[model samples]
Target chain A: SQTIHQWPATLVQPVGSPLSLECTVEGTSNPNLYWYRQAAGRGLQLLFYSVGIGQISSEVPQNLSASRPQDRQFILSSKKLLLSDSGFYLCAWSAIGDAAFFGQGTRLTVV
Target chain B: AQKVTQAQTEISVVEKEDVTLDCVYETRDTTYYLFWYKQPPSGELVFLIRRNSFDEQNEISGRYSWNFQKSTSSFNFTITASQVVDSAVYFCALSCSRVHTPLSPMDSSYKLIFGSGTRLLVRP
Candidate 1:
């Protein structure tokens, strides 16, 4: 069985602070990883996705970035957070031509 | 470009009643995939079903059923004997399939474009 772990289920940070959210997958190798953000009452927007280490494709131009340092470790980061950056962040993984599996997600509030 | 449309913004139904959520999609590619996911108040997305473009056969899983119509570009989901546990926001998503191409980290075809979700509320 595969499992994804995401940290700090909830976080409250002041504006302009740096942010780091981690996601790691177990029981799978070379899996596709993705980062998504969902605003309140809105659909999820894809932020970034990676097929391998050191490779990332960004879907939107925003204040956040994503990196896959290892085969199963993905990180979402921001040098400075904005009020609009607050949302529910989710990490997902999938094999080629398969449906995605999602993590529990992190709720970040930028005050 | 690929797009998914879930027109029902919200729906309310009493327990034991039947409910259907609509999903319509558009894509230029002949080969593609459609998916439905559920997001409860807890906010984790749970994958419900996936249907390929070639397979129009409707599927039934327990109390859940899916209708896939390629001509109409619609894939609808229905819950029979709905319960409170089925209350959640449902999302429809689409992805294009590219054959024989190496899976690149930069390939846009590997990405899924999601639609604005429909929130389902089942009353006790």
Candidate 2:
């Protein structure tokens, strides 16, 4: 079975502070990884996705960026966080022609 | 452009009542995929089901059921005898058969475009 782990489960960051949220997948190799953000009462918005290591695609222009440092390790980072950056961030993985599996998600609050 | 629409923003139903969440999608590709996901208040998304464009057969699993209608371009989900545990936001998504090429910076055909989600509140 495949599992995705994301942390810290919750985060509180000051405005303009640096942000780093890590996600890792187990039991699967070379899987497609994605970063999504869900604002309160909104749908999950795709922020970034990677097909392989060092291959990251940005779906929407924003204050966040994603990296695939390893085959199954993905990281979402920001040099300076903004108040708008607060949201529930989710990491997901999927194989071709399959539904995506999601992690527990990180609730980030930038105050 | 492929788009998914979940019409109901929120639905409140008493326990044991049958509830159906509607999903409508728009896509130009003949081959594509439709998916339904459940997100509890805990904020983790749970994959419920996936249906391809070629297969329109309805599926039933335990207390959950999915209806896929190609002619209507809709894939709806139903929860029979709902419980408080069924309270969550449900999202519908669509993806085309087109392969993603990193060279093309503007193409997201290979990615899933999610709907705004329908929040279901099942009271016991």
Candidate 3:
């Protein structure tokens, strides 16, 4: 069975702080990875996705960006955090014609 | 543009009551995919079901059933004899076939777009 692991399950960052959230997948190779954000009382918005190493696509340009440094390792980073960046960030992995599996998610609070 | 609409923002149901979560989608592509996901208070999304455009067959798994209607572009989920464990936010998503082009930039068509989600509260 495949499993997705995300770190810093909960994070509290001051405004203008740097942000780094990591996600990794095990038991699968060359899987599609994605980053999604959900604001309080709102639906999910696609942030970024990657098909392979060094291939990242931005769904919505903002303060955040994603990078696939390894085949199953994805990282979401920002040079500076904004108050609007507070939300639940989810990392997901999927194959073609299959259901995407999500991680536990990172609840980021910017104060 | 591919879009999924889960109009019901929230639903409340008593234990053992039957409930249905509606999902409506819009897309120009003839071949696409639909999915239902469950997000508990813990907040990780659990994959529930997946259906393709060509298959409109309704599926039932234990107390859960899915109704896929191609004519109406709707895929709805029903829970029979719901329990407190079923309390969660259900999301409906639409995805055009993945175009695994490592060289090409991905567009909305190759993305798994999600709806706003419906929060289901099953009280015990």
Candidate 4:
């Protein structure tokens, strides 16, 4: 069975502070990884997706960025947080032509 | 371009009542996929069902059922007997199949995108 781990389920940070959210998957290799953000009372928006290490495709142009350092490790980062950045961040992975699975997600609050 | 439209923003139903959630999608590709997910108060998006474009056979799983009509580009979900535990936000999503092409696999076209979501509230 595969499992995804997302750290710091909830975080409260002041505005302009750096942010780092890590996600990792086990029991799968070379899987497609994705990051999505869901604002309050809104649909989820794709943030970034990676097919392999050092390869990332960003969907929305914003202050956030994503990186795939290892095969199963994906990190979402920002140099300075914005008030609009607060949302539920989800990490997911899937095989080719298969349904995607999501992590528990991190709820970040930028004050 | 591929898109999913969930017409109903929110629905409320009493326990033991039947409720249906509607979803409509648009895509030029014939070999695409559609999915339904449930997001409860826990906040995790749980995959409910995945249907390929070619297979229009409706599926029934316990009290949950799905109807896929390709002609109308609609895939609707229904809960036979609603319960408080079934209260959650449901989302419809679509993804274009990875057609044989010279483009790199890393391209984001194969990625899945979600609809606006419909919040369902079942009163116990």
Best by TM-score: 4
TM-score of each: 0.95, 0.94, 0.95, 0.96
Count clashing pairs, candidate 3: 0
Write one digit per residue (lDDT tens) for candidate 2, span A1-111.
Answer: 889999999999999999999999999998888899999888999999877898888989988888888999999999999999999999999885579899999999999
Per-residue lDDT of B2-120 in model 3, one digit per residue for the tens? 88999999999999999999999999988898999999988989999999999999999999999999889999999999999999999999888746554655555667899999999
Q: List the residue pairs that clash in candidate 3.
A: none
Q: Assess the local accuracy of residue B38 in candidate 1 as a C-alpha lDDT between 0 and 100.
A: 95
Question: Which clashing pairs does model 2 show?
Answer: none
Candidate 2 lDDT over B18-99, as tens digits, reads 9999999998989888999999888888898989888988999999999999889999999999999999999999876656
- Candidate 4 off by > 4 Å: B99-102
Candidate 1 residues lying further than 4 Å off, grouped into runs, are B99-105
Q: Per-residue lDDT tens digits of candidate 4, residues B4-52?
A: 9999999999999999999999888888888999999999999999999
Q: Write the per-residue lDDT of candidate 1 for residues B1-124, one digit (tens) a residue.
A: 7788999999999999999999999988888888999999989999999888989999999999999999899999999999999999999888777643454437678788889999999999
For model 1, residues A1-111, the per-residue Cα lDDT tens digits are: 999999879999999999999999999999889999999999999999887899899999999999888999999999999999999999999886678899999999999
Ranking by DockQ: 1, 4, 3, 2
